[model samples]
Target: MPAPHGFEHLVRGDEIVILHHGVRAATLRGAKAADFLARIDTEDPQLLMARLTGNYRRGNERAARRHPRNQS
Candidate 1:
């Protein structure tokens, strides 16, 4: 499958990193999307740290608050 748009690939040491809009999204030491997703699914510490420091949760919370279904 083709890589996601707005994402660029980079190699660092033995790992491959995916940069989305110039920010890192995923990384795989073996350079495979499946590995990347699996690592993310397992909540690899590095990925978790990145997500926590990044805007992922913040953006999701904002969206949830805006959705009508979330209104009480």
Candidate 2:
């Protein structure tokens, strides 16, 4: 699959705000924000953002189970 996009982050003081498609997705504070910043450039930003914002696994289990390769 193509690399994920439309995810960005903003630092506000000690907090980090994650945005998806120009809207607020999640707000990380304290150690969470620190960890995110440390990995932001080292890891896949889009996937990390998605996972952090709880969008990575949003209701996709059923679809995955129904895939042809998953058939019994």
Candidate 3:
């Protein structure tokens, strides 16, 4: 099946690599490739990454432990 609009995909070993602007933006294994390919461009990669990996929290105390938002 073809990738949804705005996405280009390639198969490397056991992974399907999704590229944006020629960068290695994301990779999906065979099982999830179909699910990802069904998505539209309205979804942002950053948000999808956060949802799939659960590691993109933006406001955790550790996230700002050294770099305070009010730094002058």
lDDT of 1 by residue, 1-72 (tens): 222245455667777676767888767655464455556657554444345335333346667888999898
**CA lDDT, candidate 2, residue 27:** 99
Residue range 1-72, candidate 3, lDDT tens digits? 222233455678777676654666678887786676556255765455444543344555565666766466
| Clashes per candidate, residues 3 or more apart or on different chains | 0, 0, 0
Lowest lDDT sum, 10 consecutive residues, model 3, at: 1-10
Q: What lDDT would each prediction earn against the true structure? A: 0.56, 0.90, 0.57
The 10 consecutive residues of candidate 1 with the worst lDDT sum are 49-58
How big is the RMSD of model 1?
9.0
Q: Which stretches of candidate 3 lie over 4 Å from their true place?
A: 1-14, 18-27, 62-72
lDDT of 2 by residue, 1-72 (tens): 456689999999889999999999999998899999999889999999998998785567889999999999
Q: Considering only N, C-alpha and C atoms within 3 Å, which residue pairs clash in candidate 1?
A: none
The CA lDDT at 14 in model 2 is 85
Task: Give per-model TM-scores.
Answer: 0.39, 0.75, 0.39
